[model samples]
Target: MTEPEVSDSLKTFGVVLKALRDETGLTQEEFAHRVGYSPGYVAKIEQGKRFPPRDLAERAEPVLGPLAAKLLRAAARSLTRKVGLASWFHEWAAIEEEAVSLYAYECRVIPGLLQPEPYIRAIFERRLPPLSEEQFESQVAARLARQSLLEERPNSSFTFMIEQALLERRLGGDATTDALIDNLLTQGARRNVEVQIMPLRQEDHFGAGGPMYLAETPSNQWIGYFEGHDSSLLQTDRKAVSSMLRRYDKMRAQALSPRDSASLLEQMRGAQ
Candidate 1:
């Protein structure tokens, strides 16, 4: 079978990876042994015939030190650049990377940042129009890449207020839902991340406006982002952003506390 062409971004990533590996003076076979991959697989990754796995970057960190992390970030950004994410979302994505503080109120599904690989894959598979196999895989890659932000910006504060019903709905079935809950609990444990669950029984809630994302930029300016199936709006107007911020604050107040949320997740996981 003929090999499919790789994107320019991936090719650039390959070049960077190769350069980093060469700087360590390790050949493909040696580096493969160090990284616990086959020589051929390493060769394919460097040749841009294959994309590097997220775990590969983690494993490579011990061998290549901080440079490996930089390489991973660069590769992730490259993949996202070519993944063809919705145009309306591009600005939010860029802003999200530099956010000093992020607050989210989600009613539909788990926020992408906290979703596990299995959960993410299942979500994509259930899309209405049904993404093509290639499209599905690319989207999965991009979403996972975006997740890197959680780790990359350790100083940033992230707060997610999720509806209790969404978790109970179990979008990806038992096993996937279990994993998702586990992941959420793990992330919630982070000192900088707060995960709160809004009870299903709450009749009056501030997040009735659907899912919203609010972020504090590096300059301390606040912005609000809202998205639907095909379009998104970035609110820079002070009044709009302030209104969304107030709603998020109220949502956080009404939702289960982080400690209680973790308990709920544990209960859900055990039930699964």
Candidate 2:
């Protein structure tokens, strides 16, 4: 474990962003609204834990006034990303931000978007090679930033299918499981999000093919993403995307309905 991952350029960008934000006297939430992003995402940009998206300058100019644009441009000059994810993951995450519809199925661990900080910390704490203190913190911030997407895009449809075993495993013990269930319930209650569980007794699970993610872009074009080891594939081949979509469709049918899934989680809250 080492120190914080913020680079010189990133630190300067954050300093300028925070300065402009303070000068305008807008709270993080207020600035986020003006910039069309979540407050948490805006915070990360100011803290340099997440990269400033390219269009941020455009979004800030009007809200912070003409002088603000000059500061943002200066900050933008030396900007580099801070999410700490692989390049491929960065691409997939960018797509998720703008996706009109997203489907995620997982058998290994809780989907990142639905995990609480405790659960997220538990997952990263066990990495094989071990993350530096800074890497660990940055990874957590990136994931939590991504989770904000569920709330940030109210019109976008998001469905997550999780294997029952993952819920029952309690990776970080009872306290973490409690927090996890609470977070899941809270998120699932959102109108645009759906949570389903692949029951343990189901002998036929389409998602047995392994975890996958599918998203429909703003243009209505669909794509699939698959990860293996340290690498990932962003599949745009029509046939491959179609196949993933079909499996998702079948898994959606086999997994417990959202209502039942919530009930199941509630029932598991203290069963351990």
| Top candidate when judged by lDDT against the true structure | 2
Candidate 2 local lDDT, 48-86, one digit each (tens): 765666567887899998888887887787666655565
1-272, model 1: which lDDT tens digit per residue?
A: 12334677767777887888999899988998887665766776677655565456777888888867676776766663356355567678767766789998899989988989889888888888999888777778777766766776677899998999988888878888888888999899988899999988887788778999999876699989888878898899999888888888877888889999899888888876
Best model per TM-score: 2
Listed per candidate, the RMSD to the true structure in angstroms reads: 9.0, 5.0
- Could you tell me the TM-score of candidate 2? 0.75
How many backbone clashes can be found in candidate 2? 1
User: Which 10 residues in a row give candidate 1 its minimum summed lDDT?
Assistant: 78-87
Model 2, which residues run further than 4 Å from truth? 1-79, 270-272
For model 1, state the Cα shift of residue 1 in Å.
Answer: 27
Each model's lDDT:
0.80, 0.84
TM-score of each: 0.72, 0.75
